[model samples]
Target chain A: MISLKRTMLFIPGNNPSMLMNSIVFGSDCVIFDLEDAVSEKQKDAARILVRNGLKTLDFENTEVFVRINDISTKYWKNDLEEVMKGKINSILLPKTESPKSVKEAEKYIEELEKKYNIEKQITIMPLLETALGIENAFQIAKSSERIEGLFLGAEDLTADLGAKRTKEGKEILYSRSRVVTAAKAAKILAIDTPFTDVDDDEGLVKDTIFAKEIGFDGKASISPRHVDIINKIFMPSKEEIIYAHKVIDAIEKAEEEGKGVVSLEGKMIDAPIVNRARKVLLVLNKSRGVM
Target chain B: MKIKNIAIVGSLESNDVMITIEPLENKLEIIIESIVYDQFNEEIKKAVQDVCDELEVKQAKIKVNDRGALECTIKARMEAAIIRGKGEIL
Candidate 1:
């Protein structure tokens, strides 16, 4: 069963308090950020702290990820060397610009997995944070077998584009659409950028709804308060679940009657519609812990 | 490993332990002051000693100011401080 990533909370790698209590936030996933969150002087300390945290803490059901430094930086390899020795679901690659970057990281990860004697291959999620990254999103998504998702880093991307970051997010519409399209085309997850305003609950809700409508599987959250809102927004609604069940029942009935086509409430149920309904049910089951 | 200089890691934040390591002549000394000293004094000492043993530190003065940190956290901060105290970069 596939795990749903409705909300992924970022915890600073250097902060022991946050690292110890990461699982209490009720996020579908937690990302221990080693890049932007940790200062250069404390990188080594944070790495050891996070590695120990992962080794000792029992995260049980929450998917654990670590956002390492960018591939071009000197710290990424050391970051991988330390964290790969512990338990983690994936590596979040920041400032990913091209397919080559993904491949480079994957190669090193494969080597680390071998060195650590880890049987399960760790996955990778690339953060598309630059104009070049967004432009080559499709190729990057298809770059490696371990690529689990495409995450948008709107804050950096906006800076790269010299555009002002705003709560309305009108500036990132095209980038968001391109990322979703690329992810869908590659059959991978599309995770939206976080809404930076921690105090603005209304803006977070609106942004999350827009993300879901535009085909994001989840959104990264900086604050624990945003997790519940993102999860609630991404959850399959009651009416949607009921309609999905009805669609499935109608299809089953049509098959029993040996009909060539299926219809529900006079609306033709095509392959795409049936697939969408099945996805809704799948998400529902995932949310219910049926996975 | 020998502690060459004073090195400090971690913070006094809640659920964290601040470790300070400095060079000592010929003996290993550990001083611990934790919020849960009455309940976890030995456990915290053991954690620091375990890290020291793992790092093979022959001599050092280790001061632990713990704010209810977990065992793992104590060990991590101790290891980081010891490494830094050895004049080595991690």
Candidate 2:
């Protein structure tokens, strides 16, 4: 079953306690970060720690990803070397500015898979963190078969655009929408950036709701506390799930009666509505482990 | 990196391990304090020894206060303390 990434918690690669406790928080994915999270001097040690952590620990139900250093950094190669030696669900490429960067990382991942003698296909998550990355989001998402999604890196993109960062996130609305559009166009997931202000739970909820309204599939987070909230916010509500089941049942009954058009509660259930209902039910069933 | 002084890493909380390393005079010493000491004592000591060997530290005094941490946690904390003792940051 493909798990929905409603929230991905980022833990510093060098932090032992955090890494050990990562899965307990119940994030859909736990991203062990080796890029901006680790200082330059500690990159080697972080890599070793993350590699060993991935090899030794059972992450329970959470998907494991390693956020490697940017392509521009010398540490990216070593990051891939250490992380690919272990069992990983995906690799997050930071500051991905173009489709070329995604393909380059994909090539390196292939080489590493051969070197490590590992047979599993490691997916790639390219972070659209720069102005160029945001502009080229669709290309990056469609660049390679390994690319699973696009992640919005609002902080870096804001800096690249010379825009001021604010709690309201007004400056990044266009970029966020563009990323979601590009991801949708490329048939990939679009993950929104973290709220950054850990203490502002209300702000996080607001931002998450806005992201959902704008078609984002998930949100990235730095704090473990955000997991439960993000998961709760992103999941289909009880009423929505019930409605989806009713829609499916009604449609199936109609088809059995040889009717092409279906209606639920006096409202016409067209292809788009049925598709939305099916998606909701699919996500619900996946979360419940019934699919 | 070379061992220069004393350093401590990790925590003493539940599910965590705190490690302390000090420069020693040509010998390695490891002391472990764990609730599951009877079952994991040797394993914890081996973890510390392995980290020390990896860092090429010929001599050091290591102490572990483990609160039910697994072998990986022990190794990570020990490695972190070892790096910090060697005047490096992980």
In terms of DockQ, the best-performing candidate is 1
Grade the docking of candidate 2. acceptable
Candidate 1: fnat, from 0 to 1?
0.69
Ten contiguous residues minimizing lDDT sum, candidate 2 chain A: A282-291
For residues B4-83, write the lDDT of model 2, one tens digit per residue: 88987766767678888898887888888998999988888888888888878878888889988777777777776877
* Cα lDDT of model 2 by residue, A1-291, tens digit: 244788889998877778888888877899999988888766766787788899888886678999999888788887899788887999999999998898888889899999999898999999998999988888888999888889999998889999999889999999999999999898778999999999999999999999999999899999988888888789988898999899999999998999988888899998767876887886677577674
DockQ per candidate, 2 decimals: 0.80, 0.27
Task: List residue ranges in candidate 2 displaced over 4 A.
Answer: A238-279, A285-291, B1-28, B31-40, B50-69, B77-90
TM-scores of the models, in the order given:
0.92, 0.80
TM-score chain B for all models.
0.97, 0.92
The sequence of per-residue lDDT tens digits that candidate 1 reaches over residues A34-132 is 999999999989999999999999998889999999988889999999999899999999999999999899999999988889998899999999999
- How many clashing residue pairs appear in each of the predictions shown? 0, 0
Displacement of residue B15 (Cα, Å) in model 1 is: 0.3
How much is B57 displaced in model 1, in angstroms?
0.5
